[model samples]
Target: MNILQAKVLKSCLNSEEKVLYLPGNLSQFQMALILAESSKFNSFIFANKYETLARDYVNKNSSSKVKFFLTETSVADFLPIIDKVVVFFGAVTPFIINSFGKIILTCLRTRTPLYEVPHGLFQTGQNLVDNSRLINTDSFYDGVGENLPSLTNVKLSWYGENGFGYPRTVLKDAYPARVIPKFTLVTSNTNWFLYSLSDKRMFYKVLFDYAKRNSDEIFIWCPHPAELLPNTLSHSVIEFRPSNLLLYGLHNDIYFYNIESTDDLIPYCEYGISTVSTCLLDYEMHSKRVNIFNCAGVKNLIAAFNHASAFNSSKEISHNAKIINTGMLKNFDALKFDQLLSQEVSKENFIDYNYLAAYV
Candidate 1:
């Protein structure tokens, strides 16, 4: 509102090559901070939508790297200051296309450098930046993930991710990236509870089987956040390890820990296994060998691509790992899948980034 601040804010949006971010959720906001930290040009973000979240992320984890601006009216008026438009999308649901399409379509109309950051691990399909009128800018990817492929005109581009599960804007020196010599990280996912995939996708079962083969390694069972809920049928399985360690590690077979966050243990894990969890991407990035239980993510990516050229800039997902993606929907029911997907897109959980004076 001050004269000096207004000038700077206007300059940020008007300046060439400056990216204005519209993050729909905390994940998107955090990702924007990471990108801003790396960008040679300054990054501008809407202050009205997430000033509180912005300030909180900066106070806790990020340094002062991003500029926040508030528009008296819709910031859409100051389009000239924006060099590029970027949004983070995981799945291309109808809800998402509606919520974010406004700014994206606007930028495309002007032939601006419109880029989309598909934050999901695989980010399969066409990528993002789906423009009908013109060839949109390439979609930026952080890591490999299983997500809905973007529409045509959206190309995959590499921006590379430093790390997730941490604060944005600034990198902390405390959590150094180093792998444990003989530790295997096992992740819990929703599929584990399903009887169909239980035999193959079960975390404890796979760990036990894998442990039997490699006695030298310690398998750590880091359950997903929702797994421990007492209401679930698997509550009895929770042995209540107060000490949070030692699951008959006689030959270092298995070690179970009930921790709130796996941010610390994740990096130390040399090997990892998961089915559809986002952490699998992190494991693939940091771990030596990552064993994914299901090949759905891999299969989808292959189906989306014409050939192997898309994998050229991929930092994770290499041939060294045990990545086998068969594009067949073996046990998948097409009708059931379509119904579920339709329901999900129709439900509309898309968080809108609108102006709010709730900054702390």
Candidate 2:
């Protein structure tokens, strides 16, 4: 069958089943594939016209088991039956959120359960730990003071499920995965804000100077997807995408350092280089060598590698954040993420449908 036909068929079959709400581009969908599979509910991911890449990526990544549907209509259709709705990418703007507030208020007036699973994008900025706040069935915060609208009848749960296993680097087995040459500069996407800011130009400047002075070790720069300009890296530098970097044939004597998203870069604990970001909490759980950077919000991200020597070790941190209206889930923890999902659906209840059938 043709692609459109298949999508239609898929939707028809899953019309009465569980649905998952996701937004953003293809990459968001791709990153969410593993997590979605772990949910207790049989997922039918919804998207918008702008998210074609994400729709295709999720479909491909899950072997078409995960269904896709148009966003608003899908929301209207599924919100009643489904116990929880995860707003993965915040595709729903303030307008939608406001409208949802009304629906939720109605639900509250009638005493029904409604929840939101925000996948990162909240607050005004893009930093992992910026002006952001968690939006669930329970409470809402602007990351600082309590958001006034304080939702009711909804409980806030942690962000992820446990069945996917501890997070690990995706391309871990890639060629240059293990060998971190001394001059290696590992980085995350530059275009997106860690907290609504980009540190690429500043960090790159320091890296460029360091490379010019020490022309001995091969300087390798691994760029983030949000980062578009690796070509401008120093002429003597070796720019490698994660895929190709592993295969380029290099020797064993190497060291590694990375300027990545605080949450993302924490998985790399074996390396001794100190890092700066709230993500250090996860890393500290594994590696004791992490150094916490004290700057708050986007500014710290902009100052990249300015004083590499300033990296300092940190004690375990406790995020005393609060949420409201959560039914069972009250906080962010791995088990909670799983529990909220597992209790919702069972293996036998999941059905496979042809998404293309929806178009028919």
Query: RMSD in angstroms, candidate 2?
Result: 12.6
The residue-by-residue lDDT of candidate 2 on 97-209, one tens digit each, is: 54344443333343333343433322221223344454332212124323322232222323233222222223233223444333322333333333222243434344444
Q: In candidate 2, how many Å is residue 313 off? A: 16
User: Relative to the unseen true structure, what is the Cα RMSD of model 1?
Assistant: 13.9
The superposed Cα distance between candidate 1 and the true structure at residue 111, in angstroms, equals 4.6
Worst 10 residues of 1 by lDDT: 351-360
| Model 2 regions lying over 4 Å from their true place | 1-17, 25-27, 49-64, 70-81, 88-183, 188-208, 214-338, 341-360
Q: Which stretches of model 1 miss by more than 4 angstroms?
A: 1-14, 24-27, 46-51, 59-63, 69-80, 90-92, 95-101, 108-111, 126-156, 159-185, 188-265, 268-271, 276-281, 284-291, 294-360
Report the number of clashing residue pairs per model: 9, 39
Best-fitting candidate, scored by lDDT: 1
Number of clashes in model 2?
A: 39
How does candidate 1 score on lDDT? 0.44
